[model samples]
Target: MSEKKYSEKHEWVELNGDIATVGITKHATEQLGDIVFTEVPEKGKSFEAGGEAAVVESVKAASDVYSPIAGEVTESNDAIVGDPSLVNQDPEGNGWFFKIKVSDVNQISNLMNKSDYDKFVTESA
Candidate 1:
């Protein structure tokens, strides 16, 4: 287990060595209302930090989910695509969108830790 890192875009990333599992934060799901659909990046796809990594549709809006670090996507959560509500029910667990083989592990250091992210969210709200 590892501490999750966060992005200003409201994505959460759990890093284990060079691999990172990513998903939108619970606050993001709450803001989206009810997630109705999801489009995870395909395996083998590559993206930069802050890139549009996926699409999540909610009753209120369709939002682009951003990557917190640059990497080649290694896996995507088919479970979330099949049952979008999982995003709202367990955004941090089974709802994780994708996993990546990070190209630059140092990029993660630029992101906020849990406490910083919590404060950032609070200050923004």
Candidate 2:
């Protein structure tokens, strides 16, 4: 029952009930160009919308990954940390960053759907 959504900052989330699996979008990874390292947030950590939740380092630059909605991190993807190339290889799939138990599911209404996000990306470019 998860519906995938995207944020303006180039992150995507798949919300299922109270849990959301989050990660950078494919466009984001392409922009980053060969990710070298990543730091997933610790479990049990709570963050507000727009707060820094993780970090990603690529050949271009190091960037902070922001939380698109308020939630408590329930799980972190250790596989991506062990092999960062997974991010570039599969940004929307196995490369997912973390899972959060959202505090308010309604907060996601502010984000974009695939069609809107595609237009937004195109227009922004």
lDDT of 2 by residue, 73-125 (tens): 99999999999999999999999999999999998999999999999999999
Best by lDDT: 2
**Candidate 1 vs. true structure, TM-score:** 0.97
Q: lDDT of each prediction vs. the true structure?
A: 0.95, 0.95
TM agreement with the true structure for every prediction: 0.97, 0.98
Worst 10 residues of 1 by lDDT: 1-10
Q: For residues 21-55, what per-residue lDDT tens digits would candidate 1 score against the true structure?
A: 99999999999998999999999999988999999
Worst 10 residues of 2 by lDDT: 1-10
- What lDDT, from 0 to 1, does candidate 1 have? 0.95
List clashing residue pairs in candidate 1. Answer: none
Q: Model 1 off-target regions past 4 Å?
A: none
> On a 0 to 1 TM-score scale, where does candidate 2 land against the true structure?
0.98
